[model samples]
Each structure stands twice: as C-alpha cells, then as structure tokens.
Target: MNNFVKTTVLGGLIFLTPIVLVVAIVGKGFSLVHGLAKPALQVLSVETVLGAATIHIVSVVLLVLLCFLAGLYSRTAGAGRLGNWLEKRLLEKIPTYPLLKAKLRSALQPEQLETLQPIMVRFDDSWQFALLVEQVKPDASLVFLPGAPDAWSGSVCIVSGDRVEPLDVSVQRIIQLMKRLGEGAAPDLSQLRFGAHEA
Candidate 1:
C-alpha cells in the first residue's frame, strides 16, 4: 500500500475499533438480559399485561440490586479481603485497572479519610498540596501530588520525612480545587502547623 493509503487505513481502523467494540459489547449485554429476563417473565407472568418491556426493565433493576448486594458484601471484612486478594492476583494484571484504580478507590471508600490523606507537603522552599497514599516505613511515606484541572492522576513522589506536613483537609475538597485548576476556593490548611521541623 502507498504511504497515504496506509495512513488513511490506520486512522480509520483506530476510529472504528472502539466504535465496533462498544456496539458488540452493547449487543451482547442486550442478548444476555433478554435471555435472563425471559425466564423471569414466564415465572412472574407479568408479560401478559405489561408486555416484553416489563421483563427488560425488571431485569435491569434486578441486576442493579445484585450489584448492590455484591458491593455491600465487598464492604464487609472477610469478603473485602478476598476481593482484594483476587483483584491483586488477577484484576491488577490488566493495564487499565491501575489507571482507574484511584477513581474507584475514592468511590468505594468514601468515608475512609485514610484512602487519600489530604496533606500539605513542603518541598525544599515551598509547600504544595499532596495526598498521603501509604507509609512505606516509619519515616518514609508514599505521596501523590496531583496536577490541576485533572487530579485524577498524578506523580508518586517520596518526599523527605521532615518535609511532609499533615493537613486537616478533605480529599474531596482538594479534588474540587484541582478540578477547577486552582482558580476557585482552596482548602483551609490554617489548622495544619507548618512551623519549624519536628519529628
């Protein structure tokens, strides 16, 4: 193939790939729903009055309930550990999981302040907003300092132990500030002492 033709074909394939995948996935989901709903319709005999629409609607609702039940179970102590183990062994292998992992973690653990401990970490001369992911050691900690307009992703930096200053702020509030590209309201970090270094 000529250079122009090759480039055009590659561009077309790139555009069509996701569209085709979406269509295929949607079609398969509909087929599965139809199959499952058919049995429920026959058992309930709701199809006689409400028609086929009832089956599809009920199926979707039931599916949502099932997902909720699963999520509730995941929030438990034992099941959560199992799920985490399985995810680490299997799901983590997927490249996309690491990308969306942070987003999902926030959604799943809304009340867990420790999920992303909002902190005001000091650099050599200045203090920048950061999230404390975890403590590698008593002194060493993993921090994620996000960029504005898209705090969903960021650089993982391990700052000096003394430079890391804890902040009395919410992760959601910081995320909001970041989403606006720091053009709006800022988190109240006045409570956090940025005084002389102390262990």
Candidate 2:
C-alpha cells in the first residue's frame, strides 16, 4: 500500500512537473514586470511626462532598442575581441579567477581534447577507475573523475604515471556520458567490448 502511494505520487510528478514549471515561470515574469511598472508609473505620473500605458509602451520600446544594440555589438568583431580581452584581464586580477577559468575552460574545451588519452587510476593495485585528462604538468595531472551530479568538473590530483592507466576512448563518448549521467556513472566498457567482438 505504501509503495503504491509512492509510485502514484512519483508518476504524477513526472507527468505534471513541466506544466507546473512553465506556469510558475510565466507567473513570476508577469509579477516582476508589474512590480517594475508600478514604481515607474508613479514617478512618470507625478511629472505628467507619460500616462501609465504610454510609460509601459515606452519602457518596452527602450528595452527592445537596447536589446537590438546589444545583439549588434555581440556580432561585431571589435566587440568580440574587446570582450575576450576584458575577460582575460579581469581573470588575471582576481585571486580565485584562475580556478574559475580552469573549470570554464575544461567545460568548454573541444570534444577532441577528451580523446587524447584516458587516465587509468588503480586503487590498492586492484580497483581501477578511468578519468579524462584536463591538464597535465611535469609532476601533477588534472583528471576529471566522473562523479554523480556533475562530471565536467572533478578532482585535480598529482598522480604518477605508474598509478595511471591510459585508455583509447573518444572525447565525444566521454562528454556524452558526463552530460547524461553526471559524474557518478560512466560508459559501460564491457558492453562496448562485447559489441566490438560481435561485429
């Protein structure tokens, strides 16, 4: 009986969640617009600069114009270069900036980076886990261990070559597993081996 009730509630949530989310988002957006307009309307009316409807219309028009300008700027080569320059400069000034940059770079790195080599980690000479290399130094290596909830970001360990195993896996597959199962799960190698043998 308890299991039946739990299953029913879970099934209902699975079916209704998207609809609820959409309605909540729309309602919140409307509330925010109303809040902003209420204060703006009071100020505009005191000066007789615009009626409530006119003020709302003007605000919307200004927002659209700003958006258009922003879109144009983003598409321009000069703006793109400026943005990148600013990002690098700002990152250099902040103490925690390099860590954030590393995470972002790891996340956005090309899929080709994933196929370079899989680091095989052995635990006590018996257990083994595979990791994708994020960066490597002479003494330490940055490896992304697939963990539950998020896979793109993982521990940065200083592992020796003897402690690491190298595997030939495509970057795309690693990314797919990261995206689908977070870090807690990985692609099933046994299945792949069986399929390869069958083919």
Find the candidate with the highest lDDT and give its number: 1
User: For candidate 1, lDDT tens digit of each residue in 11-92?
Assistant: 5664455456556766676677678878867887664566667877776776667667888997799998898998989978
Off by over 4 Å in 2: 1-109, 125-140, 178-199
TM-score of 1: 0.66
Ten contiguous residues minimizing lDDT sum, candidate 2 = 190-199
Candidate 1 local lDDT, residue 54:
80
* Whole-model lDDT values for every prediction: 0.73, 0.55
Clashing pairs in 1: none
The reply for model 1, stretches above 4 Å from the true place, is 1-31, 39-45, 72-78, 124-126, 134-139, 185-199
- Candidate 1: C-alpha lDDT: 0.73
lDDT of 2 by residue, 1-199 (tens): 9999997787566445545654675567555656676677677664445555665565566555655788799789999998789878774674434444544456666653654465556545342335646547665566656432234334555566555655556555555565665343345453222222121
